[model samples]
Target: MQAEQAGALTVSDKPTTPMQMIAHAVANGAPVETMEKLLALQERWEAGEARKAFVAAMSAFKAKPPEIFRNRAVSHDRGKSTVFTHATLDNVCDALNVALASHGLSFRWETEQLEQGIIRVTCILTHAAGHSERTALQSTPDTSGSKNHVQAVGSTVTYLQRYTLLAATGIAVQGQDDDGAQGQKDQPITPEQVASLQAGLDETGADIQGFCKYMRVGALAEITMSGFGRAVAAIDAKRKKAGSA
Candidate 1:
């Protein structure tokens, strides 16, 4: 019977999944038609399972949002200017791991070296059911510090990894303090603010890396409301200087 032949076409319970069984059967030279059916069933099963896992993971993530702290401060303009407070890569990951784990999820990153000094970092957030989401970001070497070539590349890679992971999870650093004002720090920048910042960058023709350094923030999107004015003003100053030069 076709049913009996179909069951016989698959591998035993050790491999478990239909796909794995199909692979095992292929290695032993199973019939093409049988393999095709197994592959089709595997595809359907995987799609359904992935959808379920994604929904469950999202629910878990929303249940308890992460609370992160600003653990590092970057001094800009020779310390005569503003200090930007931010969460370090370690602090961000530390805050996220437990929360992600509780939701049966984990994340890993892959790095690629593109042409020139560009490095691409991809964060893969996976659920226990073998479903995953990925976020990729690229940045050039951090040429600001006294870092040699290797350090510059490594620093940029680390920075991109941290941000890509957070971007994928939609997790922003949350500052906490006894003062009530610190709670307001978790508020994300609005779309209007982002548009204004982009306009400033366009006017100055500023590179994103340079703009971030000028503002003393890790990324343009991370710029706070208070920082937005300073960013625009700095860009305007640069624009004026360029115009006069």
Candidate 2:
């Protein structure tokens, strides 16, 4: 009988010794060189299988279609408001950890404060079989808000960290909060905002598609009126950094 017919071990079986080789050679009545070749083939086959399994797991995770609750909002003057449908850091961590752990996939962030008060955020996704991918973004702090200096820095870090992770994973948020009954809804991106965004994109040589991904939308025209200011500021920051470089 062949060694495989006599219950040869698989990679997932956690074989700890050359015992399988010995048993296969003995059971199959095989020569030593043949046994060595068989062992090598098994190793290669196992590696290929591992890669396939990793891909399957990733596909399954992505197929589920993640959902993030829009639990926060900000009101502007004249009964105008801009609602942000974003996932909190804790919510993202909680939502992803269990699903990723099951697939031997995990993620982490590397943050750095560069000169001129720029913050760089990198999100790295790693798999158990040594495959990995990453996405990176840089931004200045949220100085326009009433936040103090530290809060401004913290806000930027938190925003970039969350977005980097989402962009890295290709996850999309699905919920939007529109609770506060208010005046006429805010309009979409205005002509002035579009001009500002286009100029910034030209100055920085940033791609419109990449900027949309960073903004978590399908197109530049989809950006809300409230988000246009922040988007313009982010692009200007990129332009400034490019100029300095």
Candidate 3:
């Protein structure tokens, strides 16, 4: 991730312990070497390298998120755009809604409600501009019922704390509360509050990249097309697993 991309992410103040780094890397099934690599890259960013090696690393981590996202109704998007889609868009929208809510910028969405019995799910986010973003998602059940032992809600909420930091820093537009502008006369999330949110995320043990994972929902929307990757991963994983078996 570039500093521009890193600028979009929130970094922690405390140096992460090797044990904690290993646990996070393993929990997500990430390569243990990944931590050292990412940390070194961050060091370059700090040292004014202007150009450290920017091998696409986020794609590798999103390959799997330690099942932390699955049970919490989250999904990995290896390489994709962050926009509305007919499939694979709900998670990002839901995550955005959650982030905005933290700053009193809540809005109503009907994607999940409408997709309850239908196979097609379209996630929507309505802004004050009298417009919205929509992503159509196709929900598929895991036939093997391999979902009983994944991470719990605690992990999901913790992950959210990490994301709130990114929301405030990446772009002022993202941090702006549309609700306040759209006739809901609420207070906007201030710059100071944004800084505080960043601080809080660090206090909770979020590593730099972990914070990126938390906020990548928007970056995925802003930087890559996410739905395409989700569809591909689902199909490929099923086919590869079946072939190996």
Candidate 4:
């Protein structure tokens, strides 16, 4: 359900949860009914305001870049002490140029109207889809130690930087990492576990049907590896019967 710069990634490193899926839906401009269904499935949002903010962040994330930037060039010489290299914003600008031709969506920057002392560049993905008028979304500005992202779905939409994988993928995949000092994931599943799971299934005749259920990360222990074991046990009898047949 995610696409990187331009590669097919199995994405075993990160597994998205129902809550994260719901959040992605909201971010991608899902309908009210869809949001309600999502809200019911995941109780991550307790307060109404928190729910609203979550939805808002998601909606903006699905937008594609609608601005053109400068180009960059690099030159290196073995004899030179300092290498001459310059990076340009050209790629961003080229993306913006292409995004303008999409449907009736008019892409524009809204930084001048900012009263918050921060620039907010908006790409109006408008008049398309179910929207009657244009939807104006501000791209999170690039600032030191600050982060911003935008993505909208049904198109090559957006979100994040180093955390792009998280935003592009889902928050659940990045939750533990974000909580840590360094942005590194802490999922503990291993090849041995999968092998163990297979052996455990064969030995105790544990249900293999529900095994895919455990092939994911959980926010807590009850929903973690141990919980997966319980799930296998719960379906053991059924799988044993099926296997014998």
Candidate 5:
């Protein structure tokens, strides 16, 4: 009768989970080795399920991505006192936090000094299910505009943190490039322009991350219409130099 009951417990209309299997084994007085195997199997199953949940939440977040805009402006002292606008870290968090939380997701940043003057910032996006994804960006300190050593490091860390979050989420700021002086028409480059630049980069063996940093944008697509010509020229120069070599 006990054996029959055990068999019945193991049989179910729905698929039996690893945990259920472990319970059935325990009730049947299974060996210690069997219990250990079942526990390992259960752990694997849970991890796989958590990963699936993470992917689903990310998809939902992207479907209705948050719209972020440039909220802070910086003015340079040289070259006609150029000014540019960028979405601050606070702006990015305010725009994304609610949406991300609603989908059971959250993010945090980690910083490391890779070498002298080079800082690497990593953005970690975690789901409620215990799965996480990370994106990292590295850059030197921003010593421009009379910043001290501390301020320069802080500036670079903030910049890398903001960009790493954006990169990890696969989102970009909407409306206007970083250059506020371009007025209202400072739109992002067209898809064709993006493709052209990508091709040039590929041909020249250029590092896309370095290129984005040099262009003062988070991604290639975020390059401004006004800056498109300059980007292309830079790429052309690289291509020519590579050909000569």
Candidate 6:
């Protein structure tokens, strides 16, 4: 019987996976407790494989990051008109859907009213293999331009959804350069600063997406020079809290 089982296992030219082993054991009438152990083992192996697949897909997706152009403009109150452009929720979906699908990934959003006026939006990015990651951001409704209560909530939800998706995918908009208008003092952080912040995140095991949301930036590289000190301080606070814990 042992010889037959060994032969059965070795018959396949490809190396056997945990699932395959478990299946074979079940077919050979393994004991109930042994079957339970094999089942747990198989579950773990599948989860590990799914995680690895998710990482590989993400790496490939980032290799040629999608360029999302700003497609919408908003006008504030007053005689003066501000011509700032930003990528809308529709634009983000149109830009990322095809690319994400090609890499076996998809994203969805969940919204919750955390408080009377505050809304939390969570973006869940999932791989076809079953691994998933989430990025969430909370913000109050936008009452600018005299928007009504419903419009204000809708606007805030849309805004949070757009940002959460970008945060999860680590994507930034390639839009018209308004930095000249904002002044040199508002320039993005240097490469060295970005590297330092990245190292801090790694050491502290902080969520990059959450950090980006907290900093009001799409990505670490988009953090402004003026905000570098604050970013460092935030990381330091997290590190100290972790240490004390």
lDDT of 1 by residue, 1-245 (tens): 99887787753445688888798888889999989999998998898898799778978797788888888776645334545677778988998899899988889999988554457688899888888877766555666548899998888788778777877898776752221133233454555556656765676788988888877778778887446435654664676579789
Query: Model 1 Cα displacement at 80 (Å)?
Result: 4.4
Write down the TM-score of every candidate: 0.58, 0.52, 0.21, 0.20, 0.68, 0.66
Question: Model 4 reaches what TM-score against the true structure?
Answer: 0.20
Q: Supply the TM-score for candidate 3.
A: 0.21
What is the alpha-carbon lDDT for the whole of candidate 1?
0.73
Number of the top candidate by lDDT? 5
lDDT of 2 by residue, 6-123 (tens): 4545544544445565575778798878888877877777677667776877897887746776555555444445443445778877778887877788899999886556677888
- lDDT by residue (tens digit), candidate 6, 1-245: 99998887778633378777777777789899988998898899999999999999999999998899987776543565445667778988999999999999999999987434556688999999999987766555666577899999899799778877988999988964331234433888766557767877898999999999999999999998567656865876787689889
State how far residue 155 of model 5 sits from its true place (Å): 0.4
Sliding window of 10 residues with minimal summed lDDT for model 6: 176-185
- Can you give the lDDT of residue 64 in candidate 3? 28
Each model's Cα RMSD: 12.1, 9.7, 24.2, 23.5, 9.6, 8.7
- Candidate that beats the other on TM-score, 1 or 2, i.e. the better one: 1
lDDT of 3 by residue, 1-245 (tens): 58866665545523365555555666778875797776676555544322121111222222321111221222223253222211122443455455543432323323221122212233343333233333333322222223432332223222232323223222222233221122212223333323433443344443545444644533222212223224223333443456566
Better of 2 and 4 by lDDT: 2
Whole-model Cα lDDT of every candidate shown, in order: 0.73, 0.70, 0.34, 0.36, 0.81, 0.80
> Clash pairs of candidate 5?
none
Q: Provide the clash count, candidate 4.
A: 20
- Model 5 has an lDDT value of 0.81
CA error at residue 156 for candidate 3, angstroms: 16
**Distance from true location, Cα of 44 in model 3, Å:** 49
- Clash statistics: count for each candidate: 0, 0, 16, 20, 0, 0
Candidate 1 lands at a TM-score of 0.58
